[model samples]
Target: MSRIGRAGFKKQVMFVLTISSFIGALIIGGAVYFFETHQVKKNAAYLIQNTTRQAAVMLNDRLNLVFTQYNKMTDKTSLWRLVNQTYQEEDSPQKYKDILECYRDMKEIYSANSEIMDSLYFATSDGTSIPLYKDMIFEKRKINLEDMFQKNYEENYGYYWLNKHEDQVFPTRKPRYVVSLIQCFKNTKGEAAGYMVLNFKSSYIEKLLEKAQISENGYMMLLSDDGFLGGTHVEEKYRLSEKTIREILHKENENMEKEGFSIYQVPLEINGWILVSVVPVGDLVSSSRQFLVILGITILIILLIAGIFSLVSASMITRPIEKLTERVIEFQTNQNVSFPVDKNMGYEMRILAEGLSKLKERVEELLRQVKEEQEEKSKLELLIVQEQIKPHFLYNTLSSIKQLISMEENQKAEDMCEALSRFYRLGLSDGRDFITIQEEAEHVENYLLIQRYRYAANFDYSINIADDILKVKLLKLSLQPLVENAIYHGIKKKEEFGTIVISGYEENDFIYLKVFDDGIGMSEEELKELQTAVGRGKVREESNHFGLRNVNHRLKLYFGEEAKLVFESTYGMYTQVTMVLPKTKGEKEC
Candidate 1:
């Protein structure tokens, strides 16, 4: 009876082990498949999006070059003279001479950029066309200049980009499509003198799209609101219908997936044209499919080996697991309890024990880190308060108020008192670390206003900040310290009166607040030492530059490591101090 009980117990253990191993394998393999597929799609989208944007930039650059040359030609006095002169009147010799001069100038420009230009010409108001290189055999079908001008011209000034159309002015045996840029020139009286036409070959745009291709099956096409302009490496079946083109143009999202293809669109700055890139989804995830297959085969083999090992090792694994459980319970009560590394146990059991031992040490280290962080927080708060209210600044402001009152300037004194009160109120910010940029600007304005009275004609200040960035949130009192530094260290030492300019603007996910002064600046050695100190972000007790270091550290602590202070100066010439911080909208309290 006892022998029979032992055999039944071993069978039960083997059954449980096999079931657990199968479930774990399924969970792990499914997770990996999901993650790998997601990662592949994200990477493909990034590549195609960047590819389309770069292609748009290249096309815009080429078109801008053509526009520049056209502007130069229009600015020429000879071209204007040719357009204003009329051959109907007498003096045929002078009319011919003016035409020849304008044609020669146009020919020079065309020769320089012949690779992109199909033809360059001018159409005058007197119903005459002057071509740089006239066709030897003129086709009977002449392009209607009046109809073309009326249809393409939007305003009476600037250039207009017309849709691609068949070439009619230039004679060719084969059918050729070209995009035209037309500009209406005005005479001295602001009257429409004539229109200048510059034709650009469509093939040049297609070549640019070809260079921006991202994959073997990927292609790019340029589309306007009306229709498609040009495409490169496009298959016949992938040609978009009129309805589909409208849908793509009106879509709210710039990047999307349709059918089995990933599509990315970028708007051209030169003209209102969309550059679209199409890539196959299958191509992007082909490697992921292969990875799934390998993962499945590996999991199956692992389960098979686990099944065989379970029958022999089930009893061995159960004993150590039971022992480890008791130790875990003990650790919960007393974290000092150590997990024993038993040599007699299996390899997995030994590894688990070693891991737990390391975990205990990590927990102790984390506690120490938390304590240090608390101390640092307290120190930062104290520094902020100290920088906000300086004893010398308060004393000088009061003395200025006293002088203004004694001179019977009660109104001026009252204004000074009011500015000081508002300054302190903003500095407190109701105990909040972050405030809107507008509030910070107002605070610094108050500080500078009071200083103007104290320094009198020694310095003057101006604040020029963009309205769009005024509502963005930033650390409270961020600008005051920089302004203080500029006045004390920069402008005070100069011989002549100095000017301090404060400017703020947002660009590319960053906020730049600059304080500039034309005064005695630091030499290279002094500037280098100051930069090093700012980088360390440690406040020196004995130094007069602690305000800068304090602000730098506080910015990093609240915002991130990327927030910093940058300094630029030339000895005895000028100084510029900039506070760079991330552009954030939400108000984060301390």
Candidate 2:
């Protein structure tokens, strides 16, 4: 071709490339925008739906737990028998004393488990009501209870759930929202003696709903056919349209836009409940506009690629300008370019992209590694905290050892000193955290001996270690905590010295190490709170059982979830703490 022909050819190539690039950019931009918008909205819907459903399930579970606890307290057949055995008529002085004792025991049980109960009343067939509260029965309750039970009442009607009563059995207290579960109990022959009515305040349901909600703006509402049983997260002056809530539950999965707000709803069918979450739509979609800039950059990069490809494949004619183009084409073909860059900016961006690509793999690996490393650190921290008091005791034991040496009883002195030395040795054994059950029993024996000497045998201790379980491994300092708590918290406050029994045995797949103290034991309420905290893996700030909790955590960490600490206590009687450990560590080894 001539010079003029080649020049026209170059102009035509540039024109076609410019038009095609513009059209292709528009197409690519539209695709990105559409794809991003669709995915983002879809993800938003999924997140809200999942969150709402979880909130609903949590509501159902929490309510069920509350009711189940109350049911167990009032409906146990054994409890009814005890009640009858306590309240029998025409009894002698000894029998009446037994009745009073049984009544006190029932009062304690009622107080310990009644976190939500407003009143628990026992109405006799003779129209007499015994309301257990403040350690005294309110006699006036029978005035209202006269209507509750008919004379010579027989056969149990099971339980009746009374809603919205607001009836206060006690007249002195302020009135509140009240619901009662009324149940009639019968003797073994199926003759009803009386009724037990359990009353609950609205605050109980409020607490339940509050615990169930997982989101800040989210609220849970208990709906029945009657509408609005109870709920939480209700804002003052903010009207909730029942129709809108029903519509949301029925028709919408994404945003249900109302005036200035959008609602998402999930229904829990178990208890006729609905969980509603509301957010301003602007808040949901405001950040999503960032995708527009990303789409624009993506189209610009695509256009650059197409333009470079066309330039590389253009004619190989030898004009002055064509020679320059031929050189550009040759460079493009011979070298591997990171991007279709005509200038310095794209080349700089390509370097940045490569750096990010290199970091991406390391960042992902670090994320997975960090969680496990952090967990290990937490376990070590627990160990360090539990081992805090060792040095002071060691110093004291050494002082005692010196005193024993001065007494001219070299055998006794040597034995005490050896025990002291071995205590620390077993504690810091090769810097390991676990030891055999036999070693743990020895450690506690040493502690008891030291204590026995210090207090002049003010408290006696008995250690019974089963030979079969002696080979089982446990965390260091596990047994000492329970013994120390028994001594200081139980025996220390008692008028007379008490006996502490440390016993260990293997049962099925687990090892049970129990510390029992026959001293001024904890109340039923104290036991209940402690057991609740242990079950939830929460330690109370005011609790004196830090060592026990620490040991409990380590056991759970090393011995699977089957490992835990259990407590049983009776006021003015005794307290027993059992540390349950799995026989093997399973996947988590020492």
Candidate No. with top lDDT:
1
lDDT minimum window of 10 residues, candidate 1: 132-141
Question: What lDDT score is found at residue 435 in candidate 1?
Answer: 87
* Local accuracy by lDDT, each model: 0.77, 0.64
Q: Residues 71-101, candidate 1: write the lDDT tens digits.
A: 7767766677766764456767777777787
RMSD of each: 18.6, 25.9
Per-model TM-score, in order, reads 0.47, 0.36
Clashing residue pairs in candidate 1 are none
Instruction: Report the number of clashing residue pairs per model.
Output: 0, 0
Where does model 2 exceed 4 Å of error?
1-379, 382-389, 402-412, 532-543, 586-590
lDDT string for model 2 (265-339, tens) is 666543434556665444444456566677668877787778775676454323334433454466446542222
Error of 2 at 465 (Å): 2.4
